[model samples]
Target: MDSPHGAAVKAEDFGLKGPRGWAFRGIGLDAAPGSLIAVEGPSGSGRTCLLLALTGRMKPTEGHAEIGRHRLPKKMAAVRRIAALGPVPGVNDLDQSLTVAEQLREGALLQRHYGAPIRSLFRSRAERRATAAARIDAALDAAGLDLATLPKGERTTVRDLERLEAVRLSVAIALLGSPQLLALDDLDIKLSDTERTEVWALLRSIAARGITVLAVCSEAPADAVVLRTGPKEDGAGAGRDADAKAEAEPAAKAEAEPAVEKDSGAKKDAETGPATATATENDADDTGNDGNDDNDDDDTKGADDALAEAGRA
Candidate 1:
């Protein structure tokens, strides 16, 4: 689990404050090297902030943390040097305008400039390019990003990628630095159930290869150390907590209902619906139109029109 820049990251009662309020407070972690840590919480609950704080990209106003040999706040720069970030919004992010290969090359250049010895600058351009290529290949392999599988291979722009594919590319770019710890924010965001499972498995595989991983998710793997953040964690009365939970349940259901209802309604309409402008039209069709006559043509026409409108939308 020992790495040049990798070490067990530990935090003791660490916390940070933002303009809105406390991002997180009284949080703790004791992740071993190469272990997977999941910071689980809802939206705007400081999961992303906690990941940055632990990685030394963000300062913790209270308590302390250790990343590699560096301590937070005091040695923020040193900590950032060893930790690699993925999709953290303002910190480190994949460039949407660049093709996959271009991004990889950029990462390799940055790594060499910062990580290599000063004497390496004297190396021939060809040699440096070769070194960069090797590092990119290794990093991509570690990240499980198969460029060949992409629609345009390495030439594909980042904006065109699937959520999971983009995540992989970001992770691969981070790995180019050979970071001791790989930390990603919002690992499960906008991903399907199967994709989430695959991402967790990928993180686990990265950890198995001796790189530490910190991921943010709404739900953590069973074996992961879960750090939760939210509005309800502070002191609160049992009555108030109950009230909050009672209130929150309906809100959550309300947020989820539209999608479920839309899907179910569409399916029902597809199965049994016959479009008529008025109730009388249905009655007229039922009585005057031959019941024995297959109205399949009319049904098919309505369905086709509906499908066309949906397509245009």
Candidate 2:
């Protein structure tokens, strides 16, 4: 498909195999600019690996991909420039100790040091600084991260911030360059439900601005194109089904036992009614447990809040 922003991302027959075994295979995707594509799978399903290949961070064993006008190369510097990654933020390999503003400044400086003209670097320091400030402001604004809210604001160190904040900071740094394609890994790792919704909204907004976003998530969002990665083992699906059954059995028993106890209680008012009451209590307890189990399952099946937030941002 053609991209809205004039940059298309395609991965054809992409497969990645390692010393252990095949991480992923038969992966093919095409994302238009302004679209959000989600790679959905369990942990260790090669989502991150696939992301690397598509973004030119790692080479696929059997196929290739294209970002914008540049094809994947043995060296991916060109593609990396146009595709900013949200994972690990700041730099591609981040320095964990740096403050938020320092990381942003360093990122802009590095981009200039590598990509800007030498004369421009020397002759227009003020202009360069202004450009960096504008880009940073735009990125932060887009991310819904107000530096002023932090105790140290821009001066707050990455290590000092919470995980969600760090994720946002990383996204802001990635946006500093105004990349054509944004690739994020595990956009929602750990966040509250409200936070997750906000994050997803932010990602959609970013896509609306004409950047293609490819994100790795455990569950697919409504607006994204979902890619499924199956379970790790052959009978994993069966095992999961069995586990669900095991969880439901106790609740079923509790409900059924209560009815039996009620039937038996019809003969006596106090003594038999005690048995019925005990059964009712057990049913309540089991129902509560079942409810908790269902909640746990939902959490597992849902997207990671931190990653989701980053995607939305």
Candidate 3:
């Protein structure tokens, strides 16, 4: 099987607002076909949402994008047909109980049944089986997975495989479709530095074959096109700092006011004491109200969870 020509990706102010809030906003990207594109960001920073949006698994609310010739939010179905997801949690996950060979066979069967042309199904059963085998072999080679090196070879279950090996298996399954665009989430999670480097090498090799690779990671490889996601220029940190200051201002004023009245008589104490104390209590209540502002960023996580659940459904 020959390698497919990769898909070109372009986006401008691409954003997705979910049930909670904006998952990602103001994203911009333009990459050529066969490019190794890495989506780098902190956890809960909408990295996964951006990956899904680019792959057509999630729709963008604010901006527009193009995957190959397919336009986003409108041509999502077409984009999905050309893009394959690799190891995205809660979406297209591998079964832990399945053996290595079983996983590969299942991927191959799914691709053959839905991805392949209807005319191809007219072939004899033996021929179809042979073709599926060839596809599996090609995908394994492209993904740099050698099953013979595993502890139990083809019989090895997913839970028993090492981290790098599991990643390789997922990539191989994605390759079974010969997708023009491959999107992988959490590419560097739970792996050593050496393994991260190796996995980047593997993705680069796949790109060398003219397949566009979109990967999500905490940090990106030097050679890949990097896109970072997070809060806007008017960031969340500044807002939190401002909120903290607002909460402290009344308390500071309340403390200073009582000091000036210390030299007053008992009558002054009776008159001003309750008022000062009441003001201080009100300030404390206000501070507690301000604390709720701290939870604004948590909405991003909620949005992500909602999207993940929608994907699974």
Using TM-score, give the best candidate's number.
Answer: 3
**Regions more than 4 Å wrong, model 2:** 1-6, 73-75, 89-94, 117-119, 232-313
Deviation in Å, model 2, residue 310 alpha carbon: 24
Report the lDDT tens digits of candidate 3 across residue range 1-313: 4588999999999976654466678889999999999998877677777787787655567778989987775555566667887877644556798788766665554554345666666877677767767777777888899989999999999999999999989888788777889988888889999999899999999999999999999899888899998764434322321222233334323433443333424212221001011122211222323222222112233333434322311
Q: Per-residue lDDT for 72 in model 2?
A: 53
The 10-residue segment of model 1 with minimum total lDDT is: 271-280
In candidate 1, residue 104 scores what lDDT? Answer: 64
Judge candidate 3 against the unseen true structure and give its global Cα lDDT, from 0 to 1: 0.67
TM-scores, all models, native as reference = 0.71, 0.68, 0.75
Residue ranges of candidate 3 with Cα displaced over 4 Å: 232-313
Backbone clashes per model, in order? 0, 14, 0
Candidate 2 per-residue lDDT, tens place, 1-313, comes to 1123725777777665543355566777787767888989876676765666566444456566777766653324445445667753211434577777666655554444333434554645466556556666777887678999998988888788876677677677666656677777667777777777777887888888898888888887987977776654433232321222233234324422333323422212111000000112212222223222212111111211211211111
Give the Å error, residue 116, model 2: 3.0
Q: Which stretches of candidate 1 lie over 4 Å from their true place?
A: 1-5, 232-313
Q: Model 1: what TM-score?
A: 0.71
* Local distance difference test scores for all models: 0.60, 0.55, 0.67
